[model samples]
Target: MNKIIEIVSSLDTNQVYAELSHPNSGGICVFFGAVREFTNNEQVTGLEFETYEAMALKEMNKLADTALEKWGLNKVVIKHAIGKKEVQEPVVVVGASSAHRSACFEACRFLIDTLKETIPIWKKEIFKNKSVWVSAHP
Candidate 1:
């Protein structure tokens, strides 16, 4: 499986991870980041996400490439949602597959962690009382 980077208006975690199967890989690790119902005791109703799509897409592809080069993984998939999402909806999904579980896990972790640290997506937290722009990273 090659790197698949999708920055779209919505996301399906299952669909994102479904394509990561590889004959050479014995294990697949996946991570899904969803809109949490609470944040520091505050109730979160929804979230709005946006990005410089072109630049974000480019950065995501680079991150996927890095994960492939840095880890012993056979596949990497990274996808993120744009626009509004209700609670429990997936905001991001990442999957990595390899001959061993550890590599798959590490690659998945690195792909998401690095993406959060370096990507250009912006998020707005929608609370029951108010909404504010927040860094999509972290």
Candidate 2:
């Protein structure tokens, strides 16, 4: 299965892992990005995420294609949460499965790093006394 993009208010790791699991897949790698409680020393109350949906999906699909081309992986799953999210909530999850552990790990890392840099997503950090909008990328 190749899930290019999924936008959900929440994600389930078990569901993602089950979807990627296969008899032919010898290894699976997963990466999760979560909302932190603080930013630049300010306490965060929550976050509101927004995106250029069409472009974001396009970039995500491209990421999946690149991973498959580079790693010859069997499957990839990318899930992202949109809308209000509280501290500790998962913001995104990437899963990759392959015949070997090396490819799975590499592809998972590549997918996440590329998505953070390339995806057109923005985050508004709601602090205790103020809020600020910033790029989703690191």
For residues 41-119, could you state the per-residue lDDT of candidate 2 as single tens digits? 8899998988888888888998999998899888999888889999998999998999999999999999999988998
lDDT digits (tens) for residues 6-113 of candidate 1: 998888665654688888889999999999999889999999998999999999988988888888678888899999999989999889988889888888888889
TM-score of 1: 0.93
- Cα lDDT, model 2, residue 38: 78
- Model 1: lDDT of residue 26: 92
Per-candidate RMSD, Å: 2.1, 2.0
Question: Candidate 1: deviation at residue 127, Å?
Answer: 1.2
| Cα distance off (Å), candidate 2, residue 27 | 0.9
Each model's TM-score? 0.93, 0.92
Estimate the lDDT of model 2: 0.87
In candidate 1, stretches whose alpha carbon ends up further than 4 angstroms from where it belongs are 135-138
Q: Please report how far candidate 1 places residue 24 from its true position, in Å.
A: 0.1
Stretch of 10 with least lDDT, candidate 1: 10-19
